[model samples]
Target: AQSVAQPEDQVNVAEGNPLTVKCTYSVSGNPYLFWYVQYPNRGLQFLLKYITGDNLVKGSYGFEAEFNKSQTSFHLKKPSALVSDSALYFCAVRDSRRSNDYKLSFGAGTTVTVRA
Candidate 1:
């Protein structure tokens, strides 16, 4: 079974500073990694993904992630943190092993709090 792990329960950052939210996963075959952010009481918004190609991938809201195949990690990073960027972030992996590959196994989630 494909699974994702978000080791951090929360991440705090000062406004204008760089921020990173870590994510790791276990999957059979080539993995499809995805990052999504959710504001308070809102739906999850897609951030970025790593399907193939370059190890470095860029996404929405000035966010980018580095895909490390050897380490099985796809860490999300922002050059500068913003108060508006504060939200609940999730790391997900598609379950390619199953017939219904649409299912996504998500991590526990990490809350990002940005302060001015």
Candidate 2:
């Protein structure tokens, strides 16, 4: 089984400041991790993913995350925060070894408030 956790319910950041949303995951086998963002009243959009190789993975909207094997973490980060970046974020995970299972378990969403 795979599971994900987003410990913080909300993250407040000032515009132009760095922004981060924490996520942790666990799986019996190799884990596939993903980050998604949702604007108000909008469906979730894929931001990034970690399938293999490279500890640091970059994604759309100038965001990135580092995969930490020891820590079992994949935290989303942006060098600068924008008011427009305010949104709900989610972390998801799947067990890669379960080829027959495509189910993804998700963490409780984190709301990011980037203030101007």
lDDT of 1 by residue, 12-94 (tens): 99999999999999998778899999999999999999888999999999999999989999999999999999999999998
Candidate 1, residue 37: the lDDT equals 97
lDDT of 2 by residue, 51-116 (tens): 999999999999999999999999999999999999999999999998986898999999999999
Q: Lowest summed lDDT over 10 consecutive residues: which window, candidate 2?
A: 95-104
Report clash pairs, candidate 2. Answer: none
lDDT of each: 0.93, 0.95
Best prediction by TM-score: 2
Each model's total of backbone clashes:
0, 0
Native-structure RMSD, model 2: 0.6
